[model samples]
Target: MAFSQQLPQGVTDLYADDYELKQALTGQLQHVISSYGYQPIQTPTFEYYDLFMNVPGTMNSDQMIKLIDRDGKVLVLRPDATVPIARMVAQSQSEVETYNKFLYVTNIFRMESGESDRSSRSFSQVGVEWFDDAHPLNDIEMIVMAIESLKQSGLKNIQLELGQAGFFQSLLQEAGLTIEQQLVVQQKVDEKNEYELSRLLTQYQVNDQIKNQLIQLPSLFGSPNYVITEAEKIAVNRGMKQSLKRLVELVNQLEQLGYAHYISIDLGLVNHLNYYSGTMFQGYIEGYGKPIIQGGRYDQLTKYFDLETSAIGFGIYLDDLISIVKKQQSFKTNQLETVDVVTEEKDFVKAMEFAQELRGKGVVVNMHYENDSTTGDPVIYLSEKKVEIKGETFTFTTVEDFLTKAGFKNGNN
Candidate 1:
């Protein structure tokens, strides 16, 4: 019952030097993550179905690639990294008091494709999580870290769209509309459809405060000063006021970081993930219509795992980012020179000694074994107690000499 068929739609191959680009991008991502004091973490590719599905605002379970485990428990390939990071932090409840900064570079599986025509299945992600650091300053740090990482990746023409979950939550409460009406309003805001938002609020018989707040949500995007001015006028829940004040502080701190020109506040931005109890931000790079980096605060995650702690984090879709990086002309690395070590079995020990010497010096050495030796070049050398040097004008002398030349001053000396 085997048949030759296409790749089940939305999957393709990456070949040749393109693979190298992926590695380069990953290296840059790790460098940025490390610079921010975040340590690397590796989590399983598959987990119990409940890990993702239990979180509200996360994607639907149907979007996951799933199968049954030996115990008949449904296991699923992770559709996203945030939930798994949350699960990890939750599992380590004792570390709640200490600040936890973790970063991960991984592959993620998604059931749906974007608006682009290219077929994609599994993609890579680099994300960071901060646990027990619930200060507004931490939120700003996360944003700055994301921006800096994208910049370090050689990406340009980036923009940040910021939003506060508290603002939306407050507007909903102040409207006093039933849950159903609130959902409708939220839907309209999410789509940035102002007319629909107004209609829903009006239909729910909401007062002017609610109607005005609903209308403002669609228009509440601009510089920090501009947003603060307008946020004062929106008469809603107290949390919304506190949220605006915090956002103002965040913007000021970003200014002090010399990245003020890169920041903008967009109240209309919705889709706050379950873990983001406060601020949420997304990063967009040139030529890529989708956000390359995203993260926010989640103060309630530890409670889910039966612990009490607050945490926030973000993940960059590394695969999508590589595509963006490939389009750039500057990220290309120079080709490495290929070296061949030529020596026969009669000189095998000599060749090996020389090769080892070169290796100790940090040079990438390719030995020409006797089985595959050619009559091209014959090079000879001398061996000391521990020092084996081949010929003059050779790439390496004794292993010790090679090590010194390659920047290894002391090797178990």
Candidate 2:
């Protein structure tokens, strides 16, 4: 309760520039997600704890922020969005029986140290879910949108790493490992711990061929064509062959769509087999400590809900993108030529009208009854006959002159 007390770790507070940057980017993300024809949907900030508890592919309870409701039912602040969306579709009783495409930009919560810190503990996640359509194009479109959205956000030097969970799944099925043993190897591989994988393969007496391929999997990444060629050599079973073929098809489609330059195959990925039923990928930008975006196909996730729907989706970590955008374009993120209008007591009426007019012309206007920016924000003060921007004041006898100089224009010139 003391002012000097600091907030929790992995959580953060956001102010003017930080907060505004996040909002504006969230809007941009919505535009990109919508353009793919994925209609928008929303889920609760918290839900019955059972919704995600022990969910095979979801994060563990230790990472989730949990509590009790008045009814005594356990509740969890939603840690992730994809699983919730899948649950929503399964529960929908729509009689039409048609395909569904959904998208949303919402806050995701996790336990952290701060009550006021809104950045790390609470994240703005924007993503899309295309259900009932299992075509490779659905997968391709999401990847393409990911690239465009990042580029649109002024982030350059992005690299997309692609892989197939099916390949690994096939390897496990052929290896005849129990669920417990399979999980052990999958975790080690997902973390790229080759030593543990080697140890497990020898301890479990895994076939020489399966062991060799599992060992080589993490290192098999490069040009799409090359990786597929390498995977083909080790793909001994029908499932492995099918997965290899699927990856080839995805690469061909990317090339046709002209996104091949951003494509590289990473055979090492071992996302929970329960999710990521097929192609999975992660996008990275320079300077970000983690992936800016990550998602994959989870066609079988619906099975848990008694629905056979096929789906693939991805989520954007808008917080990370904001950091990248801030460093890359601080001036732009500061908002478009901010104009704060202040008027004398008698001109409040005209000032309000002028503020609305500025907004109509696509400029951000801050209207204040007084002449000061309380938060130290750079302001443009508009008095009865003059406009003060920064420290320089300019006289304007006409509204048209004020509009033109402040970078606003009336329609029709």
Candidate 3:
């Protein structure tokens, strides 16, 4: 039994010019990540289920798209990229004194509710992972590289919202709520429902000061100085103060780095990705309601692999970003390199020779065996005693004459 002429829910195909545009954008992403000295890596689309099973702060069990291996092992379509990269780095024998930088342009799969129209089952991600580097400067570089990568996509009017997930985690620790209570408060805060947060705090018996801090967390966003000043006043523990100080220094250095204009601080901009152990950031451009870019530091995650690595990274959601690139700029995706070489049946030899020469010269040559309908592309037609280019026909002569009149002064040479 088959559904007639329909794709699986939330899965659609891409072809022709759309695929080309995606490839071009992917090249740009790879080039930018490479320019920053990050090596490119490709991981399998699926991995063993155990990779994520013990990893706290990652996806829940139900979220994974599960499969059964031949050996009866449970496998999953990769729900995230960073964890796989961590596993790779952990198993490597390469001796590195300081750090490792890797970037991957890959697809991730997660089960989605196509019925509710919340998301798609598949997505393209361009991301980087810097391993074993805890210096705050490394964090800043990750942010700057994210900005530059978006810029490479020809996107403008970009804004990146910065936050400290560690600060929020520290606050939760200071509150000392039970896991059930914490989960309730986290859900309320994650939804940005201050009213609900208020209600939850009211029901829970915590210190009033901690309750007030959590309630006000939603409003704690502004320019750097203002945000830091306000955060410093209420940050309860040493971790909270340290988180604030790090953010302040990050802003100051970014100012000196001359990227202050594109930066904004949002103390309330907590990401739901619980892996983020420190600074977290999200990027947005005009015409898109959701952030197209997101990444953060997750120092605790690598410990599950027992590698003792501390790192930070981010990924540009290249799937949704293509729409933004198209909407923000005027561009051409139909760049053709091959000129169709049409020939009369008898002149096939000549056409083949010309195509061979063109190929030797690193030019793409499309043989037009029988044209149906293709317009606005370069074509070279050969027949009994004539060759044609453009709309004007030319005498049967050397490829040099064709090159000369085609405005290639040194084309023949």
What's every prediction's RMSD, in angstroms?
A: 5.8, 4.1, 3.1
Better of 1 and 2 by lDDT: 2
lDDT of 2: 0.78
What candidate 1 gets wrong by more than 4 Å, as runs, is 1-5, 96-99, 113-119, 177-184, 199-209, 332-335, 339-413
Model 1: per-residue Cα lDDT over 1-413, one tens digit each: 99977766656677867777888878887888898888888889998988777776566665778989989999988778877877886787677556488889888877764643223667778888877547777787888888888888888787887888878887778777776566567767877898878887788888886787788887888787887788788845679889888888888888898998778888877763445678888887756777787777878766667656677788887777777877776475534322356555677777776667655544555675443534333222232222223333434445555455434434322
Q: What's the lDDT for residue 94 in model 2?
A: 80
Candidate order (lDDT): 3, 2, 1
C-alpha lDDT values of all predictions = 0.72, 0.78, 0.80
Tens-place lDDT per residue, model 3, 318-358, is 87878887787633453534556777667778789887876
Extract clashing residue pairs from model 3.
Answer: none
Residue 245 error for model 1, in Å?
0.4
Best by lDDT: 3
lDDT of 2 by residue, 1-413 (tens): 65766877666788976888888888777877778777888988888777786468576676688889888988888888988887888789382155488888888987644432233777878888888568887888878988888877778788888989889998888778988898888888877788889999999999998898898887888888788878888998999899888888888988998988888988887765357889898888766667788888998888877777788888888887887888777325424545667777688788787878667766667777776766443354556466665567677765567767645544222
Angstrom error of the Cα, residue 285, model 1: value is 2.1
